[model samples]
Target: MSTPLDATAIETIQGFDAEKRYKHLVKEVVANRKIWILIDEHGCVMLNTDDEDCVPVWPNKEFAEAWATGEWDNCKAESISLNKWHSRWTHGLEDDELAIVVFPIQDQEGLVIYPDELDYELKNQAKKQR
Candidate 1:
């Protein structure tokens, strides 16, 4: 049986186009154990989970740059255990935002890379090509 938290999380994701993390939770082929945590380019983890929906607050060029280079230290004062990458993004509102946490699809060589971090690096690299 699904808990109330699970149901609400699914509902929230359904309402948004991009922020919705649980958009595919109901599909028969969905991966139930998979979890994603949102983060900003600065490597500051956001406050939402894969099961929730969040609206991007604004676009930060610096934030984008940080993610691209895997420079999380600029955004976070404390050291982050997950060295792969992490991020922080504001919701449209001044105080609201979302973070999507993602883990490796499969553990590679016992090293777990955060999806948010990996995405930033990949995206950052792509941006440079253009």
Candidate 2:
């Protein structure tokens, strides 16, 4: 599960540009300890961009929930703690050559980054929080 976000907060974040949202996502994910992803019956959703196969992530359930429309309507917003992300996801995604789209919104795909890049950002953000 992920932390609850107020509707107004979600709306505010939704208005931010992709990079700003990505920065906010890194900060909030570090603070909250949860990285939100969307999953359906089969497994995690994968999006293909021109250059990468990306798994989208969000800072909170509200942001993740906002993406679950149309084809992803049946998907559920699930949380992966930062610990699990560091332990499992980074290496797994790196080996699979998958990128991450951070905090995507209805109008745009978010910042696309390599798994290790995201992991590094998360660690740096965590350090700042400390």
Q: Which candidate tops lDDT?
A: 2
The digit string of per-residue lDDT tens for model 1 on 35-125 reads 2232456443433334543321111122223233343334422222222222322112223333333221111111222334334544454
TM-score per candidate, chains pooled: 0.18, 0.95
Per-model lDDT: 0.29, 0.90
lDDT of 2 by residue, 1-130 (tens): 3457787887788889988998998998898898999999999999989999999998888878889999999999999999999999999999999999888888887999999999999999989878
TM-score of model number 1: 0.18
Candidate 1 minimal-lDDT segment of 10 residues: 103-112
| 17 Cα displacement, candidate 2 (Å) | 0.6
Error of 1 at 29 (Å): 24
* Full-model lDDT, candidate 1: 0.29
Q: What C-alpha lDDT, on a 0 to 100 scale, does residue 108 get in candidate 2?
A: 85
Q: List the residue pairs that clash in candidate 2.
A: none
lDDT of 1 at 99: 34
